[model samples]
Target: MSGLRQEIGQKAQAEGFSTPRFARLAHDLEQQARLRAFIAEGRHGDMAWMAETEERRGSPLSLWPEAKSAIVLAHSYGQEFDPLERLQDKQSGVIASYALNRDYHLLVKGKLKRLGQWLSHRAKTKVKVFLDTAPVMEKPLAQKAGLGWQGKHTNLVSRELGSWFFIGTIFTTAEIEPDAPEQDHCGSCRACLDICPTAAFPAPYQLDARRCISYLTIEHEGHIAPEFRVAMGNRIYGCDDCLAVCPWNKFAAAASDARLLARDALTSPPLSQLLELDDAAFRALFTASPVKRSGRNRFLRNVLIAAGNSGDTALVPKVTALLSDPSPLVRAMAVWALSRLTAKPEFAALRNDLMNSEADMDVRREWETA
Candidate 1:
């Protein structure tokens, strides 16, 4: 079993994955209870899918009845520099490091499929692959597989790889030896908790996704809540403040995968230029990138919030032009941006002129409120 684990690890490294670990296909009773509790408390916010697929997500056994063992893989996407440093540049939009390149779903899934095939051939057994796209509760499974422990931020953090990595899973019917699960090493450290701009962590190891900027800019649709908008700063795509402050990251290596490298354009995009993106321009710029999943409307909505928080009057013109954007979500955020950049009297004048013709209830309300 030990020799088999070493062989699998070597194979994973040669195939471009960080390392592979194995976990038995048993019910994770504690994880199941925590997940059910999270749904009951509504901490998942608008991610109702967590509740919808609770049974399947609760255990690897339930997700795949034939699965006897789970192989977990990690791929490092560590940033060469601190991602949080961009917050000082209000004129720039801060995209999460992960989204700054090609989507990991494509890259990680490809690796997982290849590895699964190799393992199937070697062990002469059926195997299945999964990435973030599946409801597999990857974090807990990764911990169970001895890859890493879940840090206080509710993200997998490794002593060797830190928190900047993507997870991939391969479930096989072949009975494989399982590694001992990792224990929490966070101790008294609260770096991830204190670094959060939105105080999204209710307690260590628990997150309120509702207040999380990543959820707001990505999964969340429509107008962002007023309280979170300003705290969002210029983080237009996703937030990484918590991940950046983890002390364990000092030992991490730079991302080896060229496909996961941050594109220069997305590293710190100019808010002024981002605000100008129409649907077609947005699609072109973000094609194959994770940001495209937000769509032009939601993406622009996030950019407008950043513009409003930018405190740069120079962006007033660009934001004003979006007052009549086809997407009501964009127009509403544009009103908020204009309100921040324009004087009350001027903003009132613009709102009065725009309100009469606006039929969207949400946009009209933004005008009335602004």
Candidate 2:
């Protein structure tokens, strides 16, 4: 152990990162293979960026050959309320626990930058920090650093902290003894697999991003597949069905960062009000939040899908108003919503009103089916 390592660990603990560990920059060939198979199978779906940076993602050495060690940090953003509590209200959409407040990338990056400066000052080494934005495979790196094992759900999980945390990485040209990776304790429990609304897990320890609602509403930019809409229920934002079902979360701590606490309006907002938000209002509501990254059109597209699944005829008028939205993707989803809302009689009237006049071919086809 080096004097620099001990000093940095004390500083990190004082800075609020729950646990910090150091790991040498070595590629885990097995995890890299799994990530390759995942992307090659097209499980990443429309998230092309995952494939674009394969080299850096597979090995930290490729990201920066001079990097001698990777410092992995974990921050628990646990919930005060049972996140599942919001799901019972069918009329109110459930936003994922992690996204209920401010974006983790921004929050964690700011802290990691401070940590990096501390490293440079103490060890006199060049350092680089990363959140989720970078190509580095953060979860695998964290596990290698003894932060925790990647749970069967493929998110890093710990016996002490469970799965309610975000992982950050700091790469530097400093030698630090690595910790042994933690063993997986997921065992025979399949709570996360059975709980998915879209059957996104082809098997345990894997995810088909196409069927994951988090991908559908966030990474996916176009109209959501019709068959999955009903299964989506009222989750207008990212889904947390898998994470909420994990029994390990019982050990998770309440978030100490005030910025991560769920805003009351977002906890279980009415589907109608969410659908009614215009672009300007949506920007105002989610300005610094992760939800804002999806942009208004993509979010409204999700809200329309939720409206269609809502089984509330009252929302049909609101959905109808978005048929002429500037984005064709939003317009197409509005057509799907109208189709789901109205029966044969009203459907016929809406079809006549929209079919031929719709400029988008996809919207026209959706209206024809409606």
Candidate 3:
């Protein structure tokens, strides 16, 4: 690395980025092809924005022609414990490690801007920074920059930082020498694939987002399909099965920032308590957290699914209360949860008492199906 490049990387490290490297933006037809195929097949599921932004997202040059080099930075949010271990405790919800605390976009975007402003002033060029909010293909670019290789689970995994990291990018007009891309080290390991609760991966390196728990619980807006609910277990926000099972995670360490640690209540949250969250309470609890973006209704929907899978009779009252919820999404899942926890005679009596009052077609279907 050049002295200037090394200096910028050192600055990024000070900003809490664990890995930083340079990549010259150039045409990569293969990455574009894969993106096209993913959208063409409709594997992106309910996220219509992926199809809308396909052209700009296809290539770095297409997004910003003036940008010659990108400083790809990886910020680690490595989990302190094995997140998968919490799954056995079905009464509690397993939140993805990344969403355990504050939104990473706020933290990472601040760090990227700090690094970008410094580089722009020193190099006398315009710079643009991006967090996960953009359509940019960060993982591929991170691989090109030698920060990490895209593991079979499709998350960038660094030799130093493992897979528990978020990517930030600073595209600049100033030309910087590019680092050689990292080669894949995921050889012969299918741990990420075998451990998936929903069998989301069709093959190594390919993900059908429709089956992905993270997408189903977060990006997906409507009612989650019945097929995946039982498989979902108690994962209320996002799933970490594949990421947690990676062999490279052995090198991972806890996040350096104190703010990244999960809140006491958020860690293995009781499904019954989560099911009781009103809009105001939910907003208050997840104020700066990524889970807030899911909105109260959709989040409650996921929590109800966890409640349904919990088989804990103690949560019955909480689940029953949601039957009259304004959100059809929540009401539907509440019906499902009641069925899972209550016996046929009891559920039938409750349904008989309330079914006629329910107007939403989807929620009615859930009532009928249950």
- Work out the TM-score per prediction: 0.98, 0.96, 0.98
Give the range where candidate 3 is weakest over 10 consecutive residues by summed lDDT: 1-10
**Could you tell me the lDDT of residue 235 within candidate 3?**
94
Q: Alpha-carbon error at 45 in model 1, in Å?
A: 1.6
| Candidate No. with top lDDT | 3
lDDT tens digits, residue span 85-201, model 1: 899999999999998889988887887888888888988889999988788999999999899999999999998888899999999998998989998889999999998999999
Q: Which residue pairs collide, candidate 3? A: none
User: Using lDDT as the measure, what is the rank order of every candidate, best first?
Assistant: 3, 1, 2
Question: What is the model-wide C-alpha lDDT for candidate 1?
Answer: 0.90
Name model 1 segments beyond 4 Å from true.
Answer: none
Angstrom error of the Cα, residue 54, model 1: value is: 0.7
Better of 1 and 3 by lDDT: 3
Which tens-of-lDDT digit does each residue in 1-370 have in candidate 3? 3888878877988999875788999888999999999999999999999999999999988989988998898888876788889999999998999999988888878888888899888889899999977889999999999999998888888888789988899999988999899999999999999999999999999999999999999999998999999999999999999989998988899999877877798889888788889999999999999999999999999999999898899999988889889999999999999999999999999989988888999988988888
lDDT of every predicted structure (CA atoms): 0.90, 0.85, 0.91
lDDT per residue as tens, model 2, 188-246: 99998898999999988889999999999888988788778888888878887788788
Best candidate per TM-score, number?
A: 3
